[model samples]
Target: MAIHPPAQEALTPPAPPAPDRLTGRARLVLLVLCAAQFMVSLDFSVLNVALPVLGDDLGLSRSGLQWAITAFALPSGGFLLLFGRIADLYGRRRMFLAGLAVFGAASLLATLAWNPAAFLTGRALQGLGAAVIVPTGMSLLTTTFPEGPLRDRALGISGTLLSLGFTVGMVAGGTLTDTLGWRSTMGLLTVAAVAVLATAPALLTESRTPDRPRLDIPGAATVTGGLLALIYALSTAAEHGFGRGDVQIALVLGVALLIAFAVVESRARTPLVSLPMLRRRTVAFGNLGGLLTFSMMTTVVFVLTLYLQEVLDLSAFGTGLVFGVQGLASVVAGVYAPKVIGRIGARRTLSFSLLGQGLFIAALLGLGADSGVWLATAAVSLASVCHLGAIIAYGLTVTSGVPNEEQGLATGLVTTTQQVGLTVGIPLLGVIATADSSLYDGVRTVVAVAAALLIVAAGVVATGLRTVSSPAGAETSPAAAKPSLAAAESSPAAAKSSPSGD
Candidate 1:
């Protein structure tokens, strides 16, 4: 007879809306960001083929040629964490735009360089610009696409283009140098940077941590110095082995500096990178998987390039063709990897892909002096399929469940693994290949070793990730879901406290 009390469902506020579809504008944003990443990667490889010509024209000594690369690698890998945190404090859009400009100007300098000094300066500046672009671009991507299938797919596409850019650059580098001259290689980067710079400012909205924290100066100096010294040692060792006095000195200095940085972080009010973030099962193991995949896969490419050219008597162009096939395979695998992650979860996908990549790399053990070029090509192509999957899955795994405010730091770690792995892996493994009596034996030994490492890494990642769920499913462990330092420090209560208070 009396009006019934409102139902409990009606008493509660309506449920929050689900994430919307990728808007027309979101697609544009993705295009611009991915373009920037592509340019960074393109520049990295595009210079490889032109190095000899550039050296002759600019009177670069053998040491100068090596410096050309080391100069770039040093800052690109070293400054990533520092710049990432800076972007989190300042505006990401501002940093990103500035990076594009620096990269463009540097490319122009290299294009017109009249001497070795000028060319080296341009290359070094390009690396510094890349350090800014990589993390900022990746952070922009994760913040823009809310976590789920949408984010997974976006990362997949980005991964596809990134790999493609490197491969394309390798091919384009040789062609452009031979046809248009060596300067065209750097000129290509100038054009690509300008294109991305033109579009990015329009689509990207500014994003950063709400509370601006003081920069971590001590943490920055120690980590950046550590990375620079570490990369220098490894890069030098790649050419001269570990016995050099400089390599030994740099190695010791790097280890000591990194240890000091750890001590600094434990005591700092606002650490550059949160120790807890690194400890997260997903973050730690995800990055490990990323490091192994990138290192081994690139090593495989290096070994095959030698085998193709030195052993099989293939020309440079023919070698490029072989890699072109592998690049296509990567594209196909990247396109479908998101769907796989959606089904099995990123953890499983990462582990399985690493395993697959290992098995295919092991197939290269069959390559011989008389072996057909197709054999090496087939092995690399198949391995690349798994490589691309691992790349996408690793990115998804690393960035999953991270808060938007700390996306810059998280992506900084992602990109650090990527750049360091690429830079360090070749040199580390190249030592093994060079140490053996014969080139063929050395390559065989290297592949065997790479396979072992990949398999071991797969086991380790699988075990670490056993209990964790995928971001696609929106499930994660309490430890991974816990607020990171940056997030915690932003809170009113945490502002008055420090890490020891916990």
Candidate 2:
């Protein structure tokens, strides 16, 4: 009689909630995700002001101190593609939480570091965590918000938070370094990471998929090693002369490895990067434009920071306060940029913004060591606005052109390019700037060159813009495109997912 009852059990059906629908809980989840994004972006620039203090406390030389920054940047930039794919194959929310955990742990380790090597290791782990967080955050946001005004608003807000995070970090870093010492900066990051981790389980929802691709181990190692080598070589050249044998050797090896990576991607059944995506006009031009734009921005910041400190003789606090004007300008510009793009269209808006950025950067050349404080600040402020507008517009274009499935890969590629540009910009431009007698004179030269680069980047976008029209005669530029797509194929996810759908 009991054996008959054992055969009667029925399987329960799974939950029926629509994945595309944005529920109240979905909005809350998105907010938490965006907060995490803000925190990660903030940490990138936050450490800039605290570097000197950290160096002194840890007995790090100038070269060693620079490694502290590079450690975070190198992993984040190089491993972006690898991590973005991991999120897609695994789960965006799961990967994001894992990243936050790693980030928190690394920050804790950094806070306790008694030597340069330990601190660098911690920074590298933090970078690895960031590599997971950034693209995954965008992917989750895209999944939660369907394409339209809501998605645009969310993306715009994310953009604003990115700039705001950097501002807050710089301000907080300086204040903390001055008051509590540099170690507190890492502690602060840890606190933020913990908050993110705690909120994630409740606010974040996981996406279910029937298939998971195998890890692209070779692709991961090749890209990571290649980028690290390239950046390391460039950074070393910045410190020591470019003529050094070690720098040359690293550069050669990096180029060779990257070439091999390209070959591997073409043959692999499950390639890490989607080579075909690189052939898309939108992806190629937008990414190249982003690279140039970010490089110019990073170089400008580097030169201005030095000019303020060395030439203007401003203290760290004073520099932060002064640079706050740029941040404010960027925030304002970033907030309004979407509206502006909506009205004028992406190509025109991008052209105008890039031209403005170039003019503003070139304008900096007119300022001398004896120039008035207001004049210098005003120049930087104007450049900041232009830079902010260009970045927002460029970001929109880059994310909008690709199909939803490729958004994550696209985003990763763009982000990686931007990071590479930034990593190389300082050294490349700094060398040119310092080739002259006076530091002020060198800065002027660098600004002029950066302005030229912006102009060229603008030209690239202008050329690409003519080709991005929809069948309806309306532009499908980043601003106009709707964000509707499934979890795996969503636009936001495409921003940093694997180039291959796998």
Candidate 3:
């Protein structure tokens, strides 16, 4: 009161100027980006619950119906790298909007389809759109948020939303297929895609990067073909025997093409994925963990849904209600996982989560046709929580290690690995499930194999992670420390002279 400057004025330096209000426009853009991400992620699981209904309606044979799922997954997984490079060369906003358009159009086509073939065609197109959307979304987010806690929070939300989408899609698909028909499920997808498309223009801004590269046509062809061949072979081997001549040929050709693509990338002026990024232990091992986690999770969903409906004689709605418990658990785990990581460290958290997931998968073997619904629900819920924890931890580890510029590529690789794992896991594990006449016995075998795979993945991550300390414990790079302290001490003139915004 006695001529003292206001306490606020003395403590704070004129607000350091409110760093540009995260403009209303920017918020809208982030919303649209996240919406597209949700749509793509939802599509991955939406069809799982609707598969039987769709097959029956369209008179699809078992193998033929399987292709409907495969058509979407195989293309999306294989084309991720190609699309990531495309987003880098073209504009992320441009690719993202185009993807939404394609996805919406495809969903419309799917809604109108009277035959399995037509529906499969639409699914393939949707996969193409997905291949574009995921990497582009990551690229846009990387450019928008800058690195640090802000980006981590944004990505954490993104990851949580993705998990939520998976849960919602399964439940919604079952409800729609039961009440409104499978076509209505497709129609729902169309609406979501259209909404994202309509909102993109006003909300999203184009990324500013110098020197966009030419499209890598050869790389795209080789990688896409390789992935297609590999997945096709896997699917066929699941249907036929692995020793089939066609399967052998496909495996050989696919491996050779992938090798050729790698060689081409090494020589290309603008490679689809930087070879050095793969050398980083975090990126490589984190992706491996994602692959294993999603692979088993997808298979578990597939098998359990079948068990609930076919063996236990539950209605679609009842099954949804049962599965909803797992969804709730996943949401809680995903929301709280960052805090858990902060306390336990990412490496330990990831290992423990994976181990938990493995035990849950093994526990599922106890559920038989006579098992109580609550028993099944509790096991699945625990597994889902573990799944969420593993995903968030691994995601944090991978994203943190890369430079801001490479986030798109890194995210694309992680998404691709999960997609490929989903595609492969279902058919591979489904084979184990179907090999026996006794349904319960087959499910037990399937769950056992999945549990083993997760355990192996946990071991791989544990071994790989021995070199690095906790996320905050060790600076991955020496340069990371200098910038923050220097920025605090710098004059305005010196701050502006720095290459990167500290």
**TM-score of each model, in listed order:** 0.94, 0.86, 0.85
- Which digits, one per residue and each the tens of the lDDT, describe model 2 over residues 1-502? 4454432222223324334335788678767887888888887887887887788888999988778887888788778887777777778789889999999999999999989888999999999899888887877776566443455556667767777788789898878888998999999999999988998898877752336666678888888889888987877777786899988998998998899899888988878888877765666776777677777887887888888888888877777777788788878876787677656655566678887888888888777786545766887788777776666666665665455455566667766876687678877888876677888989988999999988887887788776544432224644335544453343443434433434
Model 2 scores a C-alpha lDDT of 0.76
lDDT of 3 by residue, 1-502 (tens): 5685455443334324223235666567667777888888889778877888888888988888778877887777778877776776667789888888888999999999988878999999998889989888877876686444445455656767777888899888877888888898889989999888887787777762345666677777988889888887876776675788988999999999999999998898877777887777777777888888888988887888778887889887888887788878877886677666666666677788888999998888788677657777998889888888787777766666465445667777877776677677776788777678987788888888899988888988888865445344221333333445433453575544444535
Return the TM-score for candidate 1, rounded to 2 decimals: 0.94
lDDT of 1: 0.88
Instruction: Compose the digit string of candidate 1's lDDT tens values, residues 1-502.
Output: 8986655434444435546467899899999999999899887788899889888898998888988889899999999999998999998889999999999999999999988889889999999999999999999999999878778888988999999999999999999999999999999999988999988888999999998889999999999999999999988888788899999999999999999999999999999999988888888999999999998988888888887888788999899999999999989988899889888888888999999999999999999876758888898999898988999888988888888888999999999999889988888897777677888888999999999999999999999985556445533666766767765656654443433444
**Root-mean-square deviation of every model:** 4.5, 8.7, 5.8
Lowest-sum lDDT 10-residue window in model 3: 473-482
Better of 2 and 3 by TM-score: 2
lDDT of each: 0.88, 0.76, 0.76
Please name the candidate that would achieve the greatest lDDT relative to the true structure: 1
